[model samples]
Target: MSLLLDTDNSAKPPVTTFGPDFPFDYDRWISHPAGLGRLPDDQLGQEVAVIGAGLAGIVAGHELMKLGFKPVIYESSRMGGRLRSEPFSGADGVFAELGGMRFPVSSTGLYHYIGQVGIETKPFPNPLDEATPSTLIDLESEQFYVEGAGHGALPPLLREVSEAWSGALEGGADFTALQDAVRKRDIPALKAIWNKLVPLWDERTFYDFVASSPSFAQKSFRHREVFGQVGFGTGGWDSDFPNSMLEILRVVVTAQDEGQRMMVGGAEQLPRRLWHLAPTTLAHWPAGTSLASLHAGAPRPGVTRIARDEAGGGIAITDRWGDTRRYKAAIVTCHSWLLTTHIDCDESLFSQKLWMALDRTRYMQSAKTFVMVDKPFWTERDETTGRYKMSMTLTDRITRGTYLFDNGPDKPSVICLSYSWMSDAMKVLPLDAERRVRLMLGALQKVYPGVDIASHIIGEPITVSWESDPNFLGAFKGALPGHYRYNRQMFCHFMQDSLPPAERGLFLAGDGVSFTPGWAEGAVQTALNTVWGVLHQFGGKTLAENPGPGDVFDAIAPVDLPA
Candidate 1:
């Protein structure tokens, strides 16, 4: 057994049962103190073209270099991709996390790099958390405040909604069996149970499942409405009500969204650190060589086109400035939609089925706008009223989720005035930062009546409409009903050798290509899968003692229908 799985000998993962799969003990494999296997000496000088400088690209590049391959990366934007950290203009230590703020403890794959970079973390100040201080749930023209640690009981309707969901899952989904199998890391047991659920839930929407469940139907539709308002674990599920029920099951069963923490400085530190760190020795370069030094301190230009380098038995990629380069293999870590829209990728590179999967992919829309304040005003107690000045809020208004970040009472604080999704996000897409702030403020103002929110402002606000960002068409892929086949096709793309020659050298990877989308863990996991694919293409093999997830993929790959 791997030392990582031996601590307890109970088969229970370090985190909970809800994160994506960690079949290979990746954290231990990546830092094999004794070191991982090396590639053939003759392949040491060969270059691998890496597209995108995000977490996926950087991680893939770093690991490939450890095996002696030269990785030249290309990016249209700054490093970190959607894990963006916008530091306040004049204030140090304060930042607006425009993307991926909270990370679940189950994200062991992601944590391997985080720990390697020495990033500090604290439990996210989520609603009901001890660190939250207080929370205000405003909906249906009624507002209530819960004190620090969320000690008080919630409204009766909320409790009933929770009970109904628990009963429904327990009775209809064999919830206990699923959780136990996941906790045990018993892949066969998990498949034996989940395989039956795929066909049952694949064709059903989340709303359909909820409405048809005897537990939910036994209660009034009002309870259903309440359930939508205060969803299980996470906040409202109104935006996800139309998505596939299997997606919801995957999230809950894996417990992927709970017990989350935020990186102390910012999440971007992981990739930035990997960009410069040097190993004791490198395959092609001298000791102390790093990715930054390998690329002369910058990434190559954004990729504009990709095609088969047929005569060269490799793949050719063209940059935005029309600089064409060919390589023995390449890994594409960009959003899948970019293949058909922004880039002129050759049609023959992927089969018809893969193209259908890519074209049909549905990316969710998301919007977030942040403002800096002079202090953590929300934590301040109002003397006469015995109420907080403001509270971390979740509501039904335009702003569905509002978050607060405190550097310290003495320093500038960040207020994520609005963090909404789908239709709610689209409602604020057309507004500029100030206008979005005004809209969110107007909505929040009505809820708080007397709180002078604008008075504490320290600087201009930061906002993002992922749908409006050209580089990313949407926040992340949200698989819809009957989309399981498409997801399987994308997720299993690393098995490209089964496809025609045109599809062999160019591989796909990213959150969009993962079974669990919208999570950085998925991005890292899929990037590692592609690393294995590229390695095999170069005739390299994973270390026998530290095999990758792909090495055992046949037994653990997602359940799919016959061809």
Candidate 2:
């Protein structure tokens, strides 16, 4: 029989229940000194609770354990929210990233974590610098022009857009200006750049805003503009989305300035290794208990009540059956908007301004499609053209996005890979894998020639629509122009109204709070900085705020995503 620790000091009264899968292996858990089981429940005082088992929460819980703090993780779904990989049995038993692909060197902590876990990284393909001649097509004009490889492969209009974008940044137009303009509903600024800014929000439809723009209308060669928007909105003919053309453009430009890097085996390898690094911690971490309720009493300074059942010292929590347990301090890592919609938090507990800001921010649209081909068709070039390019940039005279990764880098004989971005338009499509593949292939045939892309031999495709995922409605929170300023302080002020300062002791971590705000590195940084922040609270260690979120978010290094 395992010894039970007292849980009397629980601020939030819990409705406890016990079942077959309740209490876990107490003996094994005892070996971990920093583990939850080792902490006397009376001293630990109900323990810190982390909701959402995604990387954000997982990493946060791990850091807490390292700091002699035990955290009970509550997840409504299986692990790895939007970061996942699919395994395909082929010649080399290869795998492909159906979710996230690469992380650059700029993510120093992420690289370190990968290295600490023995995950290997590989050099990204440098086709952009490979001197391969490729054709740059005007999607609107159907007028094709060829560039002799390298950085010059971009179409004339695209080159202009890039130059103009760079000029805008160099001229002191920062994210703050854009965000402020959006917040103030600065009609003039928005209207001045309405041609560029409206498309960022309106790119979900099949219509091509770039082609419709007065700028494109004046040009005799605007006919191909629809394809440009198709290319841009969809992250190119073959990409994945709900990410606007503007967002995709930002990624590309950032990649060009920052460069691309990836794990040699696959992206999943990193997280898988991290899970194994602290095997005892992950294997014994408590989960599977549904937070049946969030009982909110009268609000107190810096505190709120979040009640739960079938957790704590009860069942094993593997099969969804468990002993009901309770926790007081919980930091939810799921969608904030969803939190407001589904669960009730103390309205008086959250600041009125923060609540209003959260209400105004729209949900992000995210989807992924993975296509497996017998071979990388892009590498199989035209014998007549002698071009060995594996991918091309899909752009209108305006926006650009979409990418093809070589899933066969280690196994060329078996699986090939491609992805497309359709932004919010994917929401209207059937969410099945077949329809996704057809849509991707249909888009692909529209851009490349018959022998080049059309009628290309391929295998089955797998698509994951994150918006429909039970645990998460979207990939991440969309920080509108001014939301960053408004919500940036939410982390510090979230617990201002709670009692006993329970939340001050509880840590907050998530990409939504990060400078980058939407990428994997931002998620990692959230965890890293979270640990640093908590340690600072304990008078342990601290991080320099010199870079600041805005600078870090806009920081550009070299990237290898190709031009």
Candidate 3:
């Protein structure tokens, strides 16, 4: 159960999942220092243990190693925790991303991480440019409206409205002027400026603020659809800027070009590559062993165990074997509700109290369906409108959150369609695997008729009903009214614990801590920040200081950039 090191040091070529076609030479990129074996025992003993192996955990470990701290990572499951990407064998071995899929170009840190690992990403195809003659349907009215190629039809006033707002927000205009407008409570003018400022509002819960918006009551725009687009930002609820919906929006628009790229094999290829990237720390170290009984801290050095705490820290993290692991410090890359149980904690360690009051937080419910057909059905359109690539349809009538995924490149083509109930405040349905797949296929058929549902479904569908998965008790996290204060406090406390000086012997890193969410960027950013916090604790400089040019955040402000 434990791995103890016998030799002074051992170096080996990194194992990789990528075949020869991969762009970077993994062998050349990762090197084991030749003289590392000569270091004294005291030097080697200066160790840090990271408890999770998801994106955040891996990044944290990589960063620590770079700083000369030999990081020992402990995880109950396989590495790449929530960044779990699996290939569906039924689709002619063509991969469908079961977990975290897309990344935005705006995530400079994530992009850099991809590069560091020597993995390549291409832009995800935009669904707006295709001509498959797709239309948003309104079931109530029995009406359907088609969008023209390139840009769809927009209300005359609304067109100018959106343009003006986007210009101001992305151009970096100050929000102080907009704050003045909101303070005055001028509804029309406020609506004009609201779009520009939503990015900064991540401090506020979307459900509360949007529900209270005058626009929501007046039906000024396709509010729910717009909200969904905005919400599906960088990483989702785990993002650091939990209240800033617009920052999420910005990640998507920017990544429209970059998100189009997929792995040469599929998303699953990346995780498989990560697994082979480093030798299992468990394999080489004698003192390093799997923990069986979960404790605040246990087993001296090599002994570790999984134990269930009556109260959950975040949703209890179920190990790879489906056992629960309690924690003093946790890297929560999973869904919010999974860990949001009303568990009491030591006041001194988790004084924020929000951890105990998670029942009050609101989360949106969503369903996703993936289908592999003998041929691509969406041949009607091309890369731009999702007719051929990815597309979204919004009309006066259609149900919201319905869309098609692009699975054109692989041998057995596939398409992913999704639907969500943004305003529905209901308990997530806990369905067994058989029932979950049945509902998913049923929903997909309702959205796209004439498509052969049974013929294309080569195997059982992979379903993630946030309601059932213990690791992710619900979908993503959402803020509630006045909950912003609690959010900030919770994150600050967690970040502080991650600091090397904190002596908590625990660390925190994940989607919940990054500045953006609903995507991989947030997780990666938080991971990077976790490293920075850890390094600062060990008397090391920030990532900017240690990683050279690849640093995501500069010590100098953007304003300091030379003209």
Which candidate leads in lDDT?
1
lDDT of 1: 0.81
Candidate 3, which segments miss by more than 4 Å at Cα?
1-42, 129-149, 152-264, 278-348, 352-365, 380-410, 419-428, 432-449, 494-503, 541-563
Candidate ordering by lDDT (highest first): 1, 2, 3
Candidate 3's TM-score: 0.61
Tens digits of lDDT, candidate 3, 1-563: 00011212124221121111011111222332321112233333245555556676666555455445555555544555445555566444555565556554434545555664468665443232232234343333343344542222533433333343333333432433333333343334544554434334544543434444443444444543343332221111222233444433333233322223454455545433543343323212333222221112321221133222336422223333444444333333333343434222233333335454334445544444455556555545544434422234332211233444445643466555443333321222555545644655564455545455566556555544544444444455545434444443333433353323322433445655432334555565455445545544444433222242113222211111111
Every model: Cα RMSD to truth = 3.8, 15.3, 13.0
Candidate 2 local distance difference test against the native: 0.43
Q: How far is candidate 2 from the true structure (C-alpha RMSD, Å)?
A: 15.3
Per-residue lDDT of 5 in model 2:
14
Query: lDDT per residue, candidate 1, 167-265, as tens digits?
Result: 777776787677777766676777888888888888899999889999899999988987787674557787889998888877777667566799998
lDDT of 2 by residue, 480-556 (tens): 43343344444333223243342243344666654344567556545644544443333332223222121222122
Give the CA lDDT, 0 to 100, for residue 442 in model 3. Answer: 62
Error of 2 at 42 (Å): 11
Off by over 4 Å in 2: 1-46, 89-93, 123-138, 141-150, 153-155, 174-257, 279-305, 308-324, 341-349, 393-402, 407-424, 452-459, 491-507, 532-563
Error of 1 at 335 (Å): 1.0
* Model 1 TM-score on a 0 to 1 scale: 0.94
Task: Tell me each candidate's TM-score.
Answer: 0.94, 0.62, 0.61
